[model samples]
Target: MHPFARSLVTFAAATAAAIALHAGEAAARTPAKPTIAFVHGAFADASGFGEVTSRLQDRGYTVVSPANPLRGPASDAAYVASALQPVKGPIVLVAHSYGGAVATPAAKLVGNVKALVYLNALALDAGESNFGIIERFPNRFGEALRTRPFPLPDGTEGTDFFVDPARFREFFAADVPARAVARMASAQRAVSLSAVQEPAGEPTWKTIPSWYLIGRQDEVISPAAQRFMAKRAGSRTVEINSSHASYISQPDRVTELILRAAR
Candidate 1:
């Protein structure tokens, strides 16, 4: 081969090898991301996580937002665990509001949930019921709440709890856009009263590394209660100036915290 041509070929080979080596190093440094599973709370569904889910999906995350059975804590957790069982890999389980009460137990059942990310979510301790913990802190949540009785499958009666749509914006999402809050209120799902009274099982936050995002302006769940729970569970906590609708109003912050737990 001509001397110049031979030199050019040698340079090309070196460049190719260098590029391959860099790619290998990059791959080695980046670990495979865990699946992110979300559990929605009462008065809402999985679609409430639209912005956060979209952001995570855009970043190549495998996301699962399962419908939480609003019957009660134990039942809800069992359903969530079963839904995520088919996902093969580690999971960073995230929950909001009442869903937090469900995620802890579900994570324990799923067994591969590496971290718990709470977004203004409940972090119930063993033997603590939803209403039990909330009563520990003073809040105006009760003012917006409404309840009704429904006939159960066994022919007995069950009570369903809901936020009065007229007052939803004031207590649930004061900071969110009025239009958005209206939509949320209209589509809200009711949680059985038994759910609030049922005691939580052993908490998964006890064993897993957990992250908590507390909303200072949350009228539903008091920020003081959030701090108390996060501190007790030894979670890495960040407080934001948001309402109970923190995930909806501050999707970026919410997603950042989840990513931190995920990484």
Candidate 2:
């Protein structure tokens, strides 16, 4: 090729490369979509959020349903905080039941958490505990819980609480499909009694913009109790006529509330 022609080709290629580099830089500078980190309540694992997470992911949102240790609020919060460390950009933390307690303290540790979404979950204040609050506003389903002694890591005995499988459907997921409820019961994780009884640290909902979804038919956490906490936290509240497992039975609505918080 002629020298002039070769020079022109080289210049064109260089210009293209620079433009590509600039575009990459600009994309990097542009903020990414905030992640939705979900916390499952006691007697549940991240798998329980399959539908909700999938729907959120399909909508171009990154969703994480971390395992709640169900050890206690402090330790559970620490575990959740560690999970949040690797996540960049804004976060919309969603929790159900006891997970609310974990998310509350965990959010306090992560500045990137911009919103809190509670699905029939606990939203306790400083010096308050899941069990403590529940005690004040007792749910009839509380009578369905079955407890057994379990050995703790330190060799001491601690109580493990689970909704009796026979009553799980009636009290926890009455509105969910029978097949799914059966599966849920079989895979249920027993929450340590000590965990629910421990008091939480400062409540993050006090400062975070929060959204609460009340399951009006929730037997686990009575709707009345849910309202009390939502009102206390000044959360934007929505009521759904569902069970304690509204996120399972009404995942679309739950996901919608989560997206709203992400916004």
Candidate 3:
């Protein structure tokens, strides 16, 4: 081989080797993406998070959509905290509606929750009850809710709150497509009366960062109430023309807000 050609080959090999080493080092230094744990609110199940969860997963994020036991605030929070125990790294707890009441305390319990993302969710303060907050805001939501009696563990009857099937689409997901709204209305899960009535514990938002996506057209939890909580929690807030079921109706915007929190 000619002398100049040999030198040029050696220089190119060295440059390529250096670039590879830098790339390897950068990859090693990058932290793993946080696990996104979604907590669905009352009168709903984990399936509510399907679109957002799938979007996060597609971007290489580990996601957990745990079924929120619609019991009471304390117990539901405990259940969510326990469900997240197996997640190895940092967590971003995303809650909707009543699930926010659960995630507010559950985030603190998880110890590794780096952010709380509330999607038209209830971000209650210590000693503040969901109904207490709702009544203060005054919406047509009360007229849509109905209660059914069931036996509790203590052999006493307890109430499970549900949206009247006829009024479900109007109150919860008016912006969502008709077919999807029908599925949601038929598959609605009942949240206990205890869940809304129970007072929230110390909110995790004060300590951890928070992002809130407020639905301006929300009837279940009035936009007024949502704005009040977002201001009180000092959350990074975004608003959309949506109903309470923002995840189902406005998945792109909802997913974007969550991605911001995760980042």
Instruction: Specify the highest-TM-score model's number.
Output: 3
Cα lDDT tens digits for candidate 1, 36-85: 99999988899989999999999999999999989988999999999999
Per-residue C-alpha lDDT of model 2 across residues 124-160, encoded as one tens digit per residue: 9889988788889886877789999998779999999
Q: Which has the better lDDT: candidate 1, or candidate 2?
A: 1
Weakest ten-residue segment in model 1 by summed lDDT: 132-141
Looking at model 1, how many pairs of residues clash?
0
lDDT (CA) per prediction: 0.93, 0.90, 0.92
Model 3 error, position 168 (Å) = 0.5
Q: What TM-score goes with each of the models?
A: 0.90, 0.90, 0.91
Candidate 1 wrongly placed segments (more than 4 Å): 1-30
Please provide, for model 3 over 1-263, each residue's C-alpha lDDT reduced to its tens digit, 9 standing for 90 to 100.
99999999999999999999999999889988999999999888999889888888899998898888899989998999999999998999999999999999998888999999999999999899999998899988889999899998899999998999899989999998888888898999999888889988888899999999999999999999999999999999999999999998888898899889888
Q: Candidate 3: where are CA atoms >4 Å away?
A: 1-24
Better of 1 and 3 by lDDT: 1
